[model samples]
Target chain A: MRDLVFRNLRGRPGKTGALVLLVTFLSLTLCGGGLVLSSLRAGLNSLENRLGADVIVMPSKAALKTDLDTLFLQGTIGPYYMNMSTVNKIGRTEGIGRMTTQVFLSSMRASCCSIPIQVIGFDPETDFTVQSWLAQSRQGTLKDGELLVGTKVNVNVGESIKLYNVSCPVAGRLAPTGTGLDTAVYCNLNTIRSLMAAAGALGGYSYINGDPAETISAVYIKAADGVNVDDIVNSINIHVRKVQAVRTRSMVTGVADSLGGVSRTVTVLMVVIWLLIWVILLVAFALLAGERKREFAALRVCGMSRARLSGLVFAEAFCVSAAGAVLGILLSLVLVRSFSSLIEGALGLPFLLPSSGTVAALATVSMLVCLLAGPIASAVSARKLSRVDTGLILREG
Target chain B: MDLKAQNISKRFYRKAGESNYFYAVRETDLELPSGALSVLMGRSGSGKTTLLSMLSGLLSPDTGTVTADGRDLYSMDDRKLSAFRAARISVMPQGRAVLDTLSAWENVFLNARIAGVRDESLVPRALELMERFGIPDLKEALPKELSGGELRRVMLCRSLLLSPEVLMCDEPTGDLDDQNTALVLDSLRDYAHQGHTVLLVTHEADAVSYADRLLQMDAGRISTPDPV
Candidate 1:
C-alpha cells in the first residue's frame, strides 16, 4: 500500500506539487498570523506591567499623538517641557500614592554621543517603574555620567559613550521591550541636566532655556490602593493645570484597538483561505478520482479492498500536507524574525515576544490547522472512489 | 472447483420510461467445469460480456444464483465475496489493467500480494510468468512504456500469479497481433489444463480452435455448451 501511494505520487509530480504549494500557503498564514498576534499580546501585557503607573501626566502643550509614543516607546517628539511645579501638584493629589518624574533630552546628530538616541532621564531616588526592572540586574542607582543601555542599543555595559563632549559610562543594560525603548538610552535626572548644561555652554542642542534648573518632561503617578484609577486620572486632569493626565489603560487600549482590527482581519483572511483551499481540494480530488475510476476498479478486481484504497488516498494527502506545513512554518519563522524590528518601528507599538515555550505551542496549533486541511477536503471524493462499482467500470471500459 | 450460474437474468431500462426494460442477459444457466477452457462468443452488444460478468461475480443477476463449490457467490456480503474472488479466482478485465505508475514487475506481483500470497518464491514465480508471456525483459518498464500487445501480456502475467481455481479473461487478445494472440491463448490453454476452470469471452471466432468447450451468446440468450 505504501509503495503504491508513493508510486502514484511520483508518477503525477504536477498534482502533488500543486497540493503541497497550497498547503504551504495555508501553513504560512496560520503560523504568521499566530506569531504576530501572540507577539502583539505579549507586547501589550509587558507594556501594562512596565507602566506600573495608573495615571501619566504629560505637558499639556505636547502633541497628543507624539505624547502617546513618548509614554509607550520612551520616545521624545520635540521638547515638551512643563515646570517642576506640575509634578509637585500631582504628588500632592488626593489619591496619589507615589509619583516620579522623567526628563527627556535628545542627542545631537553630530554630538559625541552614539547616534541620536532617545535619552530618558529618570529620578532614581523616587522612580518605581524602571528602577524596579533594574533591580533584576542588581543595580541600585544610575550615578552621574553613567548610562543604562536598552537591549537593542549598540553600546554594551561597561563601555563608554560620549554624550555632547561628556563621556558617559554604560553602567547597565535592560532586557528587550520590543519597542522604541530597545533603542533608547537611560540616565538619571542629574546626568541629563549636566548634558543639557554642557550642550548649552557649547552653543549646541539645549533643553534648558533660562533660569529654573528643574524641568520635567512627564510625571508618572500610581494611584493609592482601592482608589478608582479613572477618578484619580480625572482629578489630576481637573486639578493639575498645565499638564494632561492620561490613564495608561486608555493609551494601551488605543494601540490594542488598532491591533485588534489587524488581528481580526488576519483571522478572517485565514478562515476564508482555509475554506477556499478546502473547496478547491474537494473539486480537484473529485475530478482526479473520476479520471482514475477505471484504475481503482481494476485494483479492486485485483483484490485491493475498498477501505484500504481509501486509506491510500488519505495517506497521500497527509504526506503532502505535512510536508507543506513544515516548510511554511520554517519560512514564516524566518520572515517574522527578519522583519520584527521593522514591524515595531512601523506600528510604533510596544511589541514584546512571548517565551520560547509559548512560541512552540502557537506553532503547533498552526501546523495542526494546516495538516488537517487536505485530508478533510479529499475525504468525500476518496470515499466515493472506494465504493465505485468495479463491474460497471470494467464493462464500460 | 466448478463455476455455476443458475437461471440468471439482467435487464436495462430506457431513460424516458421506467417501465420499459431491455434484457441484456436473461434466464442464463452456465456450468464451467474445472480443467477446461470455456469460450463464450457473440457479436458486440449481444450479451456475451454480460453473461461472462454474471459468471465472474462482477455483476449480480436480477434472478437466480451463482455458486462455486456449493457456496452461493451472491449470498455472501460484498467483503466476503470480494475476498473469495480475489483469493480463488483470477479476472482479466477488458482494456488496460496495468497502472501507469507501476513498473511491469510491480503490476504483475500486485495481485499476488493483494491475495496475500506470502510464498518465498513469489518474485521468481512472477518473473517466470513474465518469461512465459515472452516479456521477461520488460519487468522494470512502466505501463506507458509498453506496447498494446505487451500490456495485454502483462495483464495475463498478473492474473496467472494468483494461481486461482477459476480464471476469466475478457477479450484478452483484442489488441494483440497474431503471434501475441497465439502466445496468450497457449498460456490460457495451459492454465486450464492445470486443473483450473478458464472462461474466455470474445467476439473473435479465430480463438475457437484453442477452446475445449464453446458456448454461443445472442440477444441475451446462451446456447448449451458444445465440445470443440
Candidate 2:
C-alpha cells in the first residue's frame, strides 16, 4: 500500500502538485489569519492592563491638539502646559483616589541629541503607573540624571545618552507595551528641570519664563472604590479650570471596535476561501476519478478490495495535504514576521507577536485542518471509484 | 476451482430512479469447468462482456447466484470474495486496463500487492511472464509510453503472474498483430491446459479455432457451437 501510494504521487506529478498547492493556499490563510487575530487580541489585553489610570486630565487645548489614544498608547503626551495648581485642585475633588502629575518635554535634534524623542518626567513621590512597570525590571528608586528606557529606546542599561548637553546613564529598560511608549524615554522630575535649564541657556527654551517647577503636562487619576468613574471624570472636567478630563476606557473602546471589525472581516474571508477550496477539490477529484475509472476498475479486477481501494485514495490525499501544510506554515510565518510592522501601521493598532508556543500551536492546528481537507474532499470520489463496475468500465472503451 | 453462474440475469437502467431499463444479460446458466479453454464469441453489444462480468464476480446479477469453488460468489462479503479472487482467480479485462501511474513491472505485480501479499519470489516469475509476453524491456515504462498492443500484453502478463485456478480474458488480443494474436491465444490455451479454467470472450476468428469449446452470445442469450 505504501509502495502504491508513493508510486501514484510520484507518477501523477500534475495532480499531486495541484492538490499540494491548493492545500498550501488554505494553510497560509488559516495561519496568517490566526496570527493576526492572536496578535491583536494580545495587544488589546496588554493595553487594558497597561492603562491603569481611570482618567487623565490634560490641558484643555491638548485634547484638541493631540491624538489622545495614540498619545496614551505611545507614552508620548504632547508638550502641553497647565499650572501645577491644576493637579492640586483635581486632588481635592470629591472622588479622586490617587493622582500623579507628569511633565512632557521634547528633545532637540541639535548637536546634543541625535534624534528628537519625547522625554517624560515623572514625579517619584506622586506617580502611580510608571512605578509598577519599572518594578518589573528593577528594584531601586530612580535617581536624578539616571534614565529608564522603553523597549524601543535602542540604548542599553549603563549606556549614557546626551539630552540637552546633560548625559544620563540608563538604569533599566522597560518591557514592551506594543505602543509608542516602547519608543519613549522616562526620567525623574529633577532631570527634566536640569534639561530645561540647559535648554534655557542654549536659547532653545521659549515657554513661560522657562520655569519647569510651576507647570505640569497631565494628571493621571484613579477614582475611589465604588465611585462612578464617569462622574469623577465629569467632575474634573467641569470643576477643574483650563483642563479636559479623558477616560482611559474610551481609548480602549476605540481599539476594541477596530479589532472587532478586523475579526469579522478575517473570519468571513477565511470561511469563503475554505468553501471555495472544498468545492474546487470536490470537482477536481470527481473529474480525476472519472478519468481514471478504467485504471481503478483494473485494480478492482485485480482483486483489490473496496476498503483497500478507498484507503489508498485517502493515503494519497494525506501526502498531498501534509506537503502543502509544511509549505504553507513556513510561508505564512515568514510573511507575518516580516510584515508585522507594516501590518501594525496599516491597521493603526498596537501589534505584537504571540509567544513561540502559541505560534507553534496555531501551526499544528492549521496543519491538521489542511491534512483533513484533502481526505474529506476526496471522500465521495474515492468511494465512487472503489465501487465502479469493472466489466462496464472496460466495455465503455 | 470452477466458476459458474446459475440462472443469472442483469438489467441496466437508462436513467436513475426510472422504470425504463433493458437486460444486458438475460437469465441463463454458465459453468466454466477446469482443464480446457472455453471461448465465448459475440459481436458488438451482444452481451458477452455482461455475462462474463457476472460469472467472474465483478457484477451482481439481478437474479440467481454465481459460485466459485463451490461457494456462492455473490453471497460472500466483498472482502472474502475479493480475497478468493486474488488467490484462485485472475481477471484480464478488455481494452487499456493498465494503471496509468505504474510502470509495466509494477502493474504485473499489482494484483498480489493489492491483495496485501508481498511475494518477493514473484519477481522472477513476473519478469519471466513479461519476457514471454514480449514486454520484458518495457517493464520500467509507464502505460502512456507503451503502444496499445504492448499495453494488452502487460495486462496479460499481470493476470498470469499468480497462476490462479481460474483465468478470464475479454478481447485480450484486440490490439495485437496476427503474430501477437496467435501468441496470446496460444498462451491462453496453454494456460487452460495447465488444469486452469480459462473463459475468454472475443470476436476474432483465430480465437475460435484455439478453443476447446465455443459459445455464442446474441441479444443477451447464449448458444453452444459444440466446436471440435
Chain A TM-scores, candidates in order: 0.89, 0.89
lDDT of 1 by residue, B1-228 (tens): 998999999887756467887998989888999999999898788887777777777778899999999999989877788788889988898778778898898898878767777787878888888888789999899999998888988998888886899999999998888887888888898889999999999877778998899988888988655746
The TM-score of predicted model 2 comes to 0.91
Q: Which DockQ-derived CAPRI band holds candidate 2?
A: medium
Query: Positional deviation of A252 in candidate 1, in angstroms?
Result: 1.9
lDDT of 2 by residue, B1-228 (tens): 777788899988889899999888888887788988999998788888888888888888899998887899899888888898888888887777777888888888888887667777899999888888888899889899999999999989889988889998988988999999999999999989999999988989988789998999888888664544
Candidate 1's displacement at residue A41, Å, is 1.8
Per-residue accuracy of model 2 over A193-243 as CA lDDT, tens digit each: 787778777877576363778778878889889889999888887898889
Regions more than 4 Å wrong, model 1 = A64-66, A70-76, A111-113, A132-146, A151-162, A165-173, A210-213, A341-349, B12-21
Residue pairs with backbone overlap in model 2? A74-A180, A74-A181
